[model samples]
Target: MKGRWLVVPTVAAYATRTLRVPLAGWSLTGEAQGVGPVTRRVYWIDIASPRRPETEVVTHLLQHLPEMIPPVLAAFRRVRRGGGPTGVGDRFTVLMLGVRRGRVQVVEVDPTHFRLQTLRQHSESGWIEFRSEPLVGNSYRLTVVSQVRASSWYDRATYLLGVGILQRMTWESGLRRALKVSGGRKAGHGTTTVEWP
Candidate 1:
């Protein structure tokens, strides 16, 4: 039940975690509020399901996102801003690395997909989306997509340094967790793609 109340423990844990994320050739495609180019990263996993496992997993994540995040690496602390079941218009105050805090809002949502937009003062200016879609018989593709630019030159520098790699790892870990929690096996080898255009 780590949301707003359990932040201190996680922040304390951050001191021991090291940052050694591998680098990638991230594509900067779109304009970011005139600050810079947009970086797009996408991760997906194919789930072979006999029932509505995909929907159940999505609902679970929408209710408790911390389950998807890899605690050892990212250690991100997320707190809901409003009081009620998670849904559209929900806001989350994200504490990253126990050093920076940013705001993200649920801008759009549905049974199969949902989008979160980063608000002002956040490290990046863009949105990240989680979507589940039917690919064929008894299989679905769960995807996490993000397109954002650093909120400022300082943030961009840190991103290029290592934050970007950490972000990629976070989503990949989330996808794997979602797949495993869905009570399904991988329909095929998972894929991680970075798009620039």
Candidate 2:
């Protein structure tokens, strides 16, 4: 299966493996401080749920967030004018993907940030949180935390120890091109600067 491809060694084979403490979630609260040396705006994010299956919920979100945030904001503005939701819903497929059995919904959004939570279609408390901060340039930091739930035991261990680090390290791969020109009105401090003409 396309999804199972990411499972790799599979949960069954990792049963006997011992896990070392991963430094990722240890940051707790997903508070990212001093994003770039040029500008430090105190960026941070968090994701949490009550059970492990919730971690899968977050994983599904991560797969789609890169595209979802924008249109939702546009739709929100047009909501008062009565416009229908479009590409954005499909764009930010986190809700569509992560939410399997419950009443998945997006709670709020205000320009630079957005929030999503889930609840039982009939019950009231089972939920999860996913938040992100748009950084200088095209950079953003994301964090996911499960209240009581978490991903598979192996997933929890691997993600905490290394995957999170890998995710964070990608910050520089597109830094130069994406930041050719700064974004947002409050530039200078948090934005990245390119020297080419």
lDDT of each: 0.69, 0.30
lDDT of 2 at 38: 20
* Angstrom error at residue 197, model 1: 9.2
**Backbone clashes in model 1:** 0
Instruction: List, residue by residue over 126-193, the lDDT tens digit for candidate 1.
Output: 88889888888889888888878777776777677777778777888888888777878877645454
Deviating ranges (above 4 Å) for candidate 2: 1-8, 11-105, 118-149, 170-197
Candidate 2 lands at a TM-score of 0.29
The per-residue C-alpha lDDT of model 2 at residue 82 equals 38
Query: Model 1 compared with the native: what TM-score?
Result: 0.74
**Compared with the true structure, what per-residue lDDT tens digits does model 2 show for residues 17-107?**
2322223421122112211112111222322221223223334343334332333211111112333432222212222112111222455
lDDT of 2 at 196: 17
Top lDDT model? 1
